[model samples]
Target: MENTYYRRIFNGCLFLVPALLLCTKNFSIGAILILLLTATWYLIKEKRNYTLDKIDWMVIIILSAYFIANIPIYLSDMETTRYFKGASRYLFIIPIYFFIRHIVTETTTPRKYLDWGIVVGAVGTIVIAIYQFYVKGMPRVDGYLYSINFGYLSCSLAFLALTLANSSHIKKILWLSFLLCCFATILTLTRGAIFAIPILIIFSVIFQSKQNKCKNIFKTILIMLVFFWGMYAYSAQFKERINFTVTEFHRILSGDVADAESSGGRIQLWYAATQSFIKSPLIGQTYAQREETIRQLYQEGKISDWPISVKRAHAHNQYFEMLASNGVLGIFAIIALIFTPLCFFLKHISKSTHALTGFVFVLGFSIFCLTEVPLEQNLISSFYGFVLAVLINFTRNDLDNIQDSET
Candidate 1:
């Protein structure tokens, strides 16, 4: 009876994940429920019987290391929620991984609601973004989420939908969805996402070429290009963003950092972060301290004209943020956090059809992290955690035969 009840809750969590993603606060609550139920199920039934393999251990070690690295801050300054929230991110992978794995292994229907759930969420958001763009006349439409996160979600979903377009009947709806997502992404005007999606699409085609045949992938690429061209030609906001990017580059060249707020601000933050890291490279500062440090640098004129308002912001780059705030340990933990799943998914890419789905996810996150700290935000971070858990669990050998042939 307990087993049956846990299974039902597990399936419900899978469906709730995507639905809850439409709102950040609800998603947080939903994620907590998932963790609690997963813990209850594991403790009651699977604790002694379940065994983790090497990959699982590696993932857990990375997460634990990250958690430990943040302990110093939490111990020293228990006042702020920064340490708790930062540390909580590392906790997500375990319950999420185990819960999804249980559903896949013990249940007859695996990820039945998951794939469609993601699409349902994406389709609804895309429609809302469209309305915001045309009817609301918002230049950059973010839908229910922040603008940059909307861009990140759109970029990932566009690639995910591209992969799902492998089937004939589902292909048309997915392709249309993919196009709409691209439109929504362009409207976000997030330069990193705008740049990354094209590259992701090209690389995805190359990655799938062996299985998809060069001709079909090329045709799909061409169709995507035509869509991109249409958007580029028609979207005034897109053109203005591109023009602004060019202007920012020119300002950067002229050493007018203030005028290059869009791009140059990141460069200034990187400089400040690097200087701060040199002071304590082994075990970096806490989040609050880091903010204060940057604020001091800005005051000292060391950081030069970077606004004080955003000084409390972590380094815009994830790698830089990890190094600046968490030091060497955090860097190693993040490397493991990113690459372990990447290596696992890449290793199984050719063998499993769902492998690319997982690959594109990490790839999208990595690309986004290059410029923006996507992981720091609760919505994007939780979104990544939920998606990664589902996709990585899908990569298990138990579901190999059930893989999508399109991937």
Candidate 2:
């Protein structure tokens, strides 16, 4: 009876995890609440003697390395509080990962509910985005969050729905959900997010092909390409954006430092970040020192245009940010964070649906992170951490066995 009660509460909290991610305001609150609840349940029910698994150790190693990278910040003249807070953002996902792993083995019903919750949240966001577009005449449909975040969330939903659509049961509803998510992502007008869709399609085709369904997956990819291209061709703003990007690319090659366009600015920032990394290649610099480093480079005429009037917080690219802030260790941590789960997913993809979903998400988010600092912010990081933990837990051997036996 006691076990049953704990199980009920655990399942209820798990259902709310993904739904809370859709809300901009309640995200952190929900994350804290869920983490506390999970921790409490584990201590009270398990008598405080839980052992760490290999994946758990991997996460610990990453977190430890991240903390070590931040140690130099305190020695510098910067405020250690900010760096400490930033380093601790990933802590919320650890307990939740253990809790979900425990519950998932007992039953698969929660997976169904979790999928439905994600779909409902996606629909809610889409409706709000449409309303914002039509009623307010907004330039970009940002949904409940910023335009970039909305694009990332929409991309996540689209891929999740695609995985569901590939399943034999309930294909019709999931296909509609996938189409809705794709439409929502398009409305975001975020070129980085838009670019990730094709990569996702290609990855999906490759994964399915390994399962000996290459012809079907290839046809689906072609259809998606046509629809996406049609959307681009029909939307005047999207076309203009693409043309602007191309023009900016040429300006970059011409050494036109005066081009303040997004693409050109990104190129400049990448160059600045690479310069910073070159100076402090091992441990890099603190946030304060990194700023000063960029400013110093500009003063030395190393960077063509420093935009002295504006303050630059990060390198715009996550890889560059890690190399600048955390140095080589940070780079290794980021790589492990990405590809460790990838190795597991690829190992189990031939047998488990959960593995396929994990692969799609990790691959898509990794590609998304290349150009944008999506994983650096609190809200998006929490979202990624929570979902990633759950998926990693899903990849456990027992659950895979359960899924295999049931199938």
Candidate 3:
């Protein structure tokens, strides 16, 4: 009965993951509160159920660096803002690995159950994202599913769908669902995402390749491209974005584009971040400190007024954003935090191959994050948190296999 009660709480929390995601949309104080509460409840009642491995410590190390990046909290009001801003983003780290360890170590649930739940939920998200992107038309707020800032969530979901499909014998319904999801991804008109989708698919093909897998995968790709183009060929924005991408490629080849520079308005942000880094050099201007940093620089006539009001809330690049907000220490911490999941997954991938697919899925997300503040936005973050929580917390593979076999 006690075990069943805990499972009920766990499942209830699981359902709340999506609801809270929808409510707050991204990283939310409310969601964080709920997560912390859930963690506490488990610890207080089911004390023996709790376990955190080295991965948790690694996350702590990065987060500690981030916290240290801000000092004199009482001296400045913005210090609190910086703490929460960095902390909330970092908080997901707790739920992720800790939750996964708890699930895996508990040893009651079958591994296949977890896998199937992930497959079904992932496919469901793909379906909704597809309807939002391709058939129903893009939402005005999103410009595509989950907002324009990190709209690539749709593509990432499609990638997950494709990977799950690969792990099983192809069925007509599943294959058709995969193809529809693929078409939905392309409709978003997110250029980097368009390129990234193929990279993930190609990665899965290469990783899982067999004598016949390559041929079937290529055929699948061809069909996907044809169907996607057939549905959304009339979108001018998509065409223009592709053309701009081609132009950028040509510029790169001709030496017109500079590294850490130029692509939309990124070079400008990178330049500003660099200049800011130069002045502070140690502890950054702090998260809330950026506008003042700008104001001071602007008053001194060092930078133009035009560059001051950026649409990007933070520095456009994640690494540079940390540098701008928290300085060098923060930058390293952010990099490690963003990077460790994939590295850990890769390191232990020999123990579990399915995790490699999850790593590939994360790879596409990391790429999207490089140029855009996808994680900064609520919808994107929440979608990720909810899905990832499910990814890590779900257990019972026999149950997972049941869903897999049914499909």
Candidate 4:
């Protein structure tokens, strides 16, 4: 009876987890109330003491450093609102990660719990993303996201589906999910998506090589090329995406005579960031301090033609943004948080295919971060962390197991 109850609780939470982490999906205060009730039931019923691993320690340490480093900013000329808004990220995301980790550990393994969740979440998110892109179009509201964000989300969903596809036990439904993910990624017209997908394919090839996998891959790529070309030809924005990608690719290869437009306004932002860094090199500016800081920079002729009217939140590059906003310790925390899992995963590449899928996702997102600040929004961070949590779950013998005819 106790075992059945535990399994039931786990299954319910499994469904709830993905819903909470999706873009188009929302759970109300009432839902949170219900979740609290069930979670209380699970907690009260628990017998064993919990043990957190090194990853947990790493997350806590980074978040702690992030908070501690920001204390000076809060003490400085920054507003109380700005202080809390900046500080709240550590509070919100950190505990939530612990909570997520607990929920994941409740199951025997994180693999299928999240795999099933993502399959459901990805399909639903894809539908909403598609609807928003085709039916609604652009120029979104104050609180809502633009259609282009959906394009980015599409790529993210595709990446997750593709990661799941890497496992030997991929079912037909999961394969179909991958197809939808790929199709939706294309529809987004995200040029970065175009560039990033090759990582997935390359890794897929690398892992599947010497196993007679290239033939199917070649045929699939041929079909996808035809589809992409046709779709690219039809949509002006998509065509522009292709053109811009090719133009930039060529420029990068050719050592660039002209056209820095590929990473539009990135140079300007980088310049602004460096100038900001130079002024207060040690402590750097607080979240509240950014507006006035940039304003002063523009007015003083330090950063010329930088838009004063636009409220800039970040350096537009993740690494630079952290260094500028959070300072030396903050930057280190960010680095440790990102790279710890990577280093850990690299050490345990007995399952190379699974490791390669994660690598592809990381590569894709790293490229995305170069142009867009994905972590700015709560939903994006929550979704990304949750998906990554799932991908990490795939590094398992049981999950990655294939049928052995010889055995």
Clashes of 2: 0
Q: Candidate 4 lDDT, tens digit per residue, 1-407?
A: 76556545545555555544334443412233344465555655664477877666765664455466566656775555443343344444454444444554423454565467657766766675567566777322111354344455556656656655656365566667767766666665655565566656665565546666777678657876787788777877677767877777676467542244535345556656666566666666765466667677667865544445445546667666666665675566556545655564555554445565566566566666666666545455545454444445444332335323224
TM-score to true structure, per model: 0.86, 0.89, 0.71, 0.74
* Residues 196-295 of candidate 2: C-alpha lDDT, one tens digit per residue: 9888877877776655577767787788778867866888877777788788878878988557467666666777677767878877777666677767
281-400, model 3: which lDDT tens digit per residue?
Answer: 666555445666666666786555654676433666767776765567666666665576567555544334455555676687788866766655545654544444343333223334
lDDT of 1 by residue, 114-211 (tens): 55555665676677777888899998877767788888877777776676466324666666766767767887888888888777777677777777
- What is candidate 2's CA lDDT for residue 291? 72
What local lDDT does model 1 show for residue 106?
22
| Top TM-score prediction, candidate number | 2
Superposed model 2: Cα runs more than 4 Å off = 27-32, 62-68, 74-80, 84-86, 167-169, 209-214, 257-260, 306-312, 397-407
TM-score of 4: 0.74
TM-score of 1: 0.86
Q: Give Cα-based local distance difference scores for all models.
A: 0.69, 0.69, 0.54, 0.56
lDDT of 4 at 199: 57
Ranking by lDDT: 1, 2, 4, 3
